[model samples]
Target chain A: MKRFGKLEYYFAALITITFSNTILGEGFDSTAFITIFVALTVMYKGLVVIDHFMELKEANRYLRMMMRTYFFFFPSLIILSTMF
Target chain B: MSSIESSNTLAIFPRSWSQQNAGRVPGNIPIWVGILSELTEFGIFFTAYFIAKFNYPEVFASGPLSLNTTIGVSNTVILLASSFFMAKAMSNVRRDDYKKCERYLWYTFICACMYLSFKSYEFYWNDLQGFSTKTNEFFTVYYYMTFNHFLHVGWAACAILWVIFRLRSGAYSAKEHSGLEALAVYWHMIDLMWILIFPLLYVLR
Candidate 1:
């Protein structure tokens, strides 16, 4: 479990860096695609922290749901703000 | 040890809570409550930010352009790495490896320090470029949000130091380290918040 958890962490970190480069790279335009990409990337990073790093997966259903909901809810909000 | 005796030994948390949530959550229930409250607070901040952006669309539109994207990305990576080390610390503690836990905590602290340093420089760079709270509505919220997050990271750093001290004095063990777990959860919360904040202020154009 520990080894697999470490691999998960590394994978999340690698994904974050890869997307960050795309967003921060030169002349990168923030169109609808980039906006959605950023929102999804942020959501993915938050989930990793909540579930794997915080080990909320082993937690009670309510506890896990509550924390997981934040990631989803806020990214939805971000998407809403962008559309408007 | 009797259940009661073990509960007494772990009196940092309410005995009932310790018993009730022993395997239910990652840390103390009270800390989860605090985390919930903190998340709500940030929720309010995000609402305010969006409202301000709605009111001042022009200001919001150009806000990310002036900011240093490099600094924002660096800080994001730093916090992510720091959270990783903190998680490792918790795993070590769970394995009854205090030495490895302490080492990982130090690594977390170093990453935290690097974040603070980069943030300080970012602020300095902002000042040099004549961006301040008074610069515009965007900067006003920018300063408010980042400063609030900074205070949080500052508090978490102090908590990390305290946890290290207690760990050294044998206050935590594999079986009863709710305090350490709580600290790890709190640190991860900080990281989670930054994950939201980074794009809102920097990458989202």
Candidate 2:
């Protein structure tokens, strides 16, 4: 389990670095890449880390549901508002 | 049948353990609420950023170019390191290593202080350069967001200090360390908010 957790951390770091460099480079589109990265990272933290690993889901069902609602609502609202 | 064995059993089965861990397995509501509140605040900032960008893109562009990217990047790294230490502190508490927990908490607090100092330097230099909050809408948001985050850092530092004092006074056990959990959650939230804010305001503006 610990090794798996370490692997996950490495993967996250790799993603962050790659995306960061890409965003930094000229001729790269910022909006699409940032939106994608933010969505993926937030989902990973909210669903995978907090809910699964942190055991928040088991501890507080209502809070878990509220989190799910929040993750779904806020980003989508922002994206939609930006779009139209 | 020695006195030491009896004392060991009593230590292992303290009354506080049952009382503290009884409410929920691991109470993390304080952290949950704190993060949610921060997310709302960040969302508001993002909305304002979009509004400013739509109205005056050139102004926002000039603002980011003037920022010290090196300091921003260093602060990001520092906050990430603090999160790691905060996690370690929680782990120490779980293992009933109060001394180690206090040490890690102090390290996290130091990182928080360092982050605030860098931020203060940035703000001071900006002000000396005549970039006050009244400079422009862009500078207004810049100061507002960063200053608000600084307040959070100070609050987290104080909480960490309180946790250290509690640990020293034997006020927290492995089972009853809600304070540590709360501090860790707040520390992580602070780091997470910066991860977004640094790139948005400093790098990608």
Candidate 3:
């Protein structure tokens, strides 16, 4: 039997995380916890795409850091706006 | 970073400094420039989204309730799947599996078509609900942001087709497939942008 490739596994994980984030966010009141949770999920998904799909893991340190920063910055902004 | 190898300092880093020398930017440097510009464009749009959102918290809070979550979520899934297929195609190409790479590209093209179809249906659904760019601040942001993204996806779809044709012509191989890698990266960026947008527009109530 042919098992799933590493990229396939990453894709599955991303899909799972996406749906779980949506369901949990929508199933309950949009509390701070839920909002932060969603933000974190977005960050995780972005990082996966950057590192794996974009093939940035072995990329130049500066370029890799720049991509990572974009993912972190936006999610943090989302959290910040929700707070105040 | 220089690609030169210095054997003497390889041990100090411990994580295989030799491999560290292998680190280089993925795809073409020019494509990275384009990616940066795309990111800036979407970054500005996101800024506007947050500004309007904070200004009218009630409107932002209730905006998503009116949108079609089913279409939005479906499109998100489609884009994610498309990017995955694109990534798979790139991996196959790197392994000199041109046949598999071509197959995966077709899969990605199918996903892109599905996404565009659902998105168009979403616009019609919005029209039925009497939503438009003039609806309100919330709807205005929604329409503009999503429409811009829709256009990007369209361009990316064309690029995928171009890459497919080029591959068929034997333009790519394991030893030199930067063009394919570039398209994959661009496609993933499109998918990543939507990953953020979907939650904001459909789920973050």
Provide the overall lDDT of each model, using Cα atoms, as 2-decimal numbers.
0.82, 0.66, 0.86
TM-score of chain B of 1: 0.88
Candidate 3's error at B19, in angstroms?
12
Candidate 2 CA-lDDT value = 0.66
Indicate whether candidate 1 or candidate 2 has the larger lDDT: 1
TM-scores, all models, native as reference: 0.88, 0.73, 0.92
List model 3 lDDT by residue over B105-170, tens digit each: 999999999998999999999999999999888999999889999999999999989999999999
| Candidate 1: residue pairs that collide | none
Clashing pairs in 3: none
Residues B1-205 of candidate 1 have per-residue lDDT tens digits of: 7976664333565554443454466677678889989999998888888899889988987998999988888888888888888988988898999999999999998888888889999999999999999999999989998999998998899899999999999999999999999999999999988888888888776
TM-score, candidate 3, chain B alone = 0.89
Residue B22 local lDDT, model 3? 40
DockQ of predicted model 1: 0.48
Model 2 regions more than 4 Å off: A1-61, A64-84, B1-35
Please give the distance, in angstroms, between residue B35's alpha carbon in candidate 1 and its true position after superposition. 1.1
**Model 2 lDDT tens row, B13-122:** 45432323322434444465667788788778867877776687778767877777767877876776677677677777889998888888888888998999999898
Q: Tell me, by DockQ, which candidate is best.
A: 3
Pairs clashing within candidate 2: none
